[model samples]
Target: MRDIMGMMGKVKEMQAKMEKMQEEIAALEVEGKSGGGLVTVVMTGKGELKSVKIDPALFKDDDVEILEDLLVAAHKDAKDKVEAVAAEKTKAMTAGLPIPPGFKLPF
Candidate 1:
């Protein structure tokens, strides 16, 4: 039964690591920009938008639609970056665990 006990210990250790990783990810902040750096957004690893910035030069009435589009693009960029960060962290945490390729986390 030593093997089972050792496995249990490892499982507990992995659980603690996963908890810490989740905390770190929740505290992560990332920025994404678009439209020649005219638009930018900051987001947390949880996909929550924290802030947005747009260059004042895009204030023209005709550029409203363009500005809107840039805002959307910037948000998408930020969300993608957040996902990448979370995925990288999860991958690192699960390294050599023999998890299925398509498995999801949060166990």
Candidate 2:
């Protein structure tokens, strides 16, 4: 009985922590650059694209394909960063729990 109560308490505590962690993740922002800094992407942890920046030099009429490629690369980089940060936060939040290896939290 005591263990059950304790476990419930922990569950509630974890729930509260998760709520706060989610808020923190939602507010997180990261930047990614590509093409030797010719393009950059800014994205939120929730994977929403906030903005993009491309160097004026990349605005060539003949190099539209290159610019498009750089934009894609930059977006991918930012997405990876966002995932990394989210994983890190999830790990920290679940520290000391009995979660199994490779078990992902539902963000």
Candidate 3:
């Protein structure tokens, strides 16, 4: 049962590390831009939208649809960045662990 006990200890340690990582991720902010920086979005690592910025010049344009599209693109960019950051941090946190390759944590 020693092996099992050791494994359990490792699991507990990993859990703590994961919790800390989650908090770190929640505190991170990433910025994304679109339409040659005319539209920008800020999002937390958890993919929550934090804020949006639009160039004043875009207001001079009459096509609202284009502005809408740019906003969507910018939000998507921010979301992608957030995912990238999460992946990076997770990789760091999992380094040297016994987890099988391609296995995801936190179920």
Off by over 4 Å in 1: none
1-107 per-residue lDDT for model 1 (tens digits): 99999999999999999999888988889998999899999998787899999888888666688888999999898888878888998998899999999888963
lDDT of each: 0.89, 0.91, 0.89
What order do you get sorting by lDDT, best first? 2, 1, 3
* Clash total of candidate 3: 0
Worst 10 residues of 3 by lDDT: 98-107
Give the TM-score of each candidate. Answer: 0.91, 0.94, 0.89
Cα-based lDDT at residue 22, candidate 1: 88
Global local distance difference test of model 1: 0.89
lDDT by residue (1-107, candidate 2, tens digit) is: 99999999999999999999898888989999999999999999888999999899876677888998999999999999888888899999898888999999887
Winner on TM-score (1 vs 2) = 2
Give me the displacement of residue 8 in model 1, in angstroms.
Answer: 1.2
Candidate 1 accuracy as TM-score = 0.91
For model 2 the TM-score comes to: 0.94
